[model samples]
Target: MPILKFPPIESADEQGIVAIGGDLHVESLKLAYKKGIFPWPISEDYPLAWFSPNPRAVFDLNNIHIPKKLKKFINNCSYKITYNTAFERVIRKARDIHQNSIHGTWITEEVIAAYIQLFREGHAYSVEVWEDKELIGGLYGVCFGKFINGESMFHIKDNASKIALLSILSNIKRADIKYFDTQMITNVTGSLGAIEIERPDFLDYVANTTAEKEINFQNFSLHLDFDL
Candidate 1:
C-alpha cells in the first residue's frame, strides 16, 4: 500500500483517520509517527486506520502519582526493572492480557511485527519487570521528541504493571520528558494522573514541543525506588 501523508487531519480534532487500508510496513510506521499518526484499527484483519485523536490523553511525567502502597512496594521490592531488554516478551504479554479482557485485543500479529521493527530501529521501547529472572510484566511505547506514546501494559502479578509504570515515570522524571501521551482516556490511565486536554491545546503543545528537542532513551536506566 502507498504510504499516507499528513495534513488531512481535521483542525477541530487534529485527528486524521487516514487510509483505512494498508500494511504495517516499517517505513510506513516510521513516517506515520513522525507526523503524529498511529494505527489503531479494531482488529488485525481490518483495514489499517491511522489516528491522531483530539483531546489526547496525556500524562505529564512530573505529575504521575505514586500511591503510598505502590511507593512502598517499589522502595523494598527485589524485582528489577529493565528497558528494551525483552520487547517481544512484553508485547506478547500485553496481547495475552488484552485477549483475556472483555474488550479483547487489537495487538495483532501484524502489529507485533511492526512494533518489533520499530524497536529495532530505536523508535519503540519496553520496560520490563523481573523476579528471580522470570518476566512478570512490562509496558511498551513509541518515543518521539519529548513525548512518549504509551501503547499498552500488562502484569502477571498484583501491581506488576503498576511497578512498570512507576518505573517509567521515574525514568521520564530523571530524563525530563515533558509529555507522556496515552492516546485515549480510561480508568486505568486516569488513576495514573493522565488528563484530557482540549484538541487545540494538545495540538499547540505538540507543535511547540515535537521539533524543539530530542529524547534519547538510552541515556537512562530503570530504577525501582518507588515505595511499592
Candidate 2:
C-alpha cells in the first residue's frame, strides 16, 4: 500500500476528515500527527481514515479533575504507574478492551506496528500500571507540541486506568504543558475532566498554546511524586 497525503482540512467546522486511504507506516504516522491528523478505521480491512475532528475533546493540563473518591484510591492504592515501561503490552490491552466495547476498535495490527515504531522514536508513549509486579492497566497516545492526544485506555483492575490517567496528567502539569487532547468525548473521558469545545475554540487553544513552545518528547518523565 502507498502512503497517503491529506488535503488541507476544509474548515474547523468540517470535522477535518483529511483523507480516507493509507498505510499505517511509521513515517506516515509521524507526518500525520505533526499536522494534527490521526488514523481511525472501523476494522483492519477498511481503508484507513484520517481525522482532525472539529470540536476536539480536550483537558486542560492543570485542570484534570481527580474526583475525591479516585484521589482516595490513589492515596491508598499500592499500584504504581510508570511511563514507556511496557508500550507493546499497553497497546495490546487497549486493543483487547476496545474490541469489547460497542464502538469496537480501529487499532489494527498495522496501527499497532506504526505506534510501536513511534514509541521507539520517542513520539508515542504509554502509561503503565503495576500491582505487585503484575500489569493491571495503562493508556497510550502521541505527543506533539504542547498537546498529548490521548488515544485509548484500559484496565484489568478497578480504577487502574484512572490511576494511569491521573499520573499522566500530573506529569503534564508538572512539565507545564498546556493542552491534552482527548480526540473525542465519551462519558468515561468526561468524568475524568475532558470537555468538548467548538472547533474554532479548540484550534484557538491549540494555536495559542503551541505557538511559543515545542513539546520535547525526549524530556518527558513520569517519575515525579504525584500529590493527588
Candidate 3:
C-alpha cells in the first residue's frame, strides 16, 4: 500500500488536478472517491492525475431523464442487460471505444488491474449491454452508498451507450441509489439528464453515505429505471 495524501479540493488550481503519481492501490482509489476526487490521465504516457472539478456534474436519481426517443429505442431493442457480469470486458471495451472517440485514455493496463481488484473486493461493478450474444456497449464505475459514480462507457453502434446508461439507472434503485456521479459534465452526459452542482455540495452528499451504511444492491427493476 502506498502512503498517498491529497490536498483539499479547494487547493486545486483552475485545472482541478490536485495531485499526481500515486500507485492505484485499492485503498488509494477508495480514498480518492471518498474525497470526491478521481483519476484521469492526460495521456497514455503521462503519470496519473487526480481531479475534483468544480461545477461537479451528477444525475439526480429523482430526475434522471431518458429522452423519449431513447426510451422508445430501449423498449424496442433486443438487448439483454446484466450486472456484475463480464466486468473486465465492459471496462476493456469502454477503454477501447472511448479512446477512439476522444484523446488521452486513462484506462491503461494498470488501471484495469486496479479496478479489477476493486471489483473482486465488491466495491466496483459494471453494466453490460448485449445484443444476440454480442457485447455491444457498456459502462463501469465505483459505487458508494446511495451513489454509483460512472467511470467510462463505449458503444459499437448508435445508442448503445445510452442503453447501458439507462439499464444501470433503471436497476440501481434496487440498490437504493439516489445519485449518479458523472465526474464531469459533457454534451453527451448533459443530453442524458446529468446536471452540474457545486463540488462542495457533492462532497457533502457523499459524506453522509459510506460503505458502512450501504451495500452492493442486487435485483433491479429494469422497466422502472428506463421510465425515469
Candidate 4:
C-alpha cells in the first residue's frame, strides 16, 4: 500500500479534524500517531476521522493530582496490575463500555483490529488491573519513544480504571517521561491534573521529547506499594 499523507495541523478547522475517510492500515495508523494525529470514527454512516485537537489535554507527569479518596483507595485496594498482558482485552472492554453509553463509541471492529496489530508490533501498550483471576479495569495507548498517547480506559469495578492509570503513571514516571497525553480532557481527567495546551506547543513537545529509545513495557509493571 502507498503511504498516507496528512495535511498540516494548522489546516484543521475549529473542530481539529485534519482529515476524514482513511483506512486503518497499521502504517497509516503509525504515520498519523507520529504526526500527533489520531483516528476517531464519527459513526457507521461517516468515514473515519482524524484529529489533532487544539488545546490538547495532557498530564504533567510531575504534578498528577490524586484525590484524597482515590489515594486512599489505591493504598487499600488489593488489585494487581500488569503491563502489556491483555491489551486486546482492555481495548475491547473499553469499546463495550463506550458502546453501551448514550454517546456511543468510535471503537469499531476496524479500530480494534488496527490497535491489536499495533500492540503486536510493540508500538502500543496496556496496563491491566486484576483481582486474583478476574480482570476489572485497564487502559491502552500508542507510544512513541517517551511520549504516550493514552487512547482509552475502562473499569468494571469502582475506581478500577483510575487505579490502572495511577499504576501506569507511576511506572512511566520512573522511566522519566514528562507528559501523558489524554487527548481530550474530561471532568475525570481534569480532576486528576490534566491541563490543556495549544496544538503548536503540543506538537513541538512531541517532536522534541520523542527519542529512538524505546520503553520496555514488558519489563514495566506496577508495584502494589505506590507513592501518589
Better of 3 and 4 by lDDT: 4
- The C-alpha stretches of model 2 lying farther than 4 A from their native spots are 1-4, 11-16, 204-228
Q: Which ten residues in a row have the lowest lDDT in candidate 1?
A: 11-20
Best by lDDT: 4
Q: 42-148 in candidate 4: lDDT tens per residue?
A: 88889888999998999888899988898788778889898888999999999999999999988999889999999888889999999998999999999888878
* 1 against 4, candidate with superior lDDT: 4
Report the number of the highest-TM-score candidate: 4
Per-prediction RMSD in angstroms?
A: 2.6, 2.8, 1.9, 1.3
| TM-score versus the correct structure, for each prediction | 0.88, 0.86, 0.92, 0.96
CA lDDT, every model vs. true structure: 0.77, 0.76, 0.79, 0.86
Please give the lDDT score for candidate 2: 0.76
What ordering of candidates by TM-score runs from best to worst? Answer: 4, 3, 1, 2
- Superposed on all Cα atoms, model 1 deviates from the true structure by an RMSD in Å of 2.6
Error of 4 at 130 (Å): 0.4
Per-residue accuracy of model 3 over 1-228 as CA lDDT, tens digit each: 753688878998688888887878889988898888888867767788899888788887788777778777766778777778899999998787767764646788889999999999878988888888999888899876655688998888778877878777767644567778898877778898899898888888878765445555465543424646
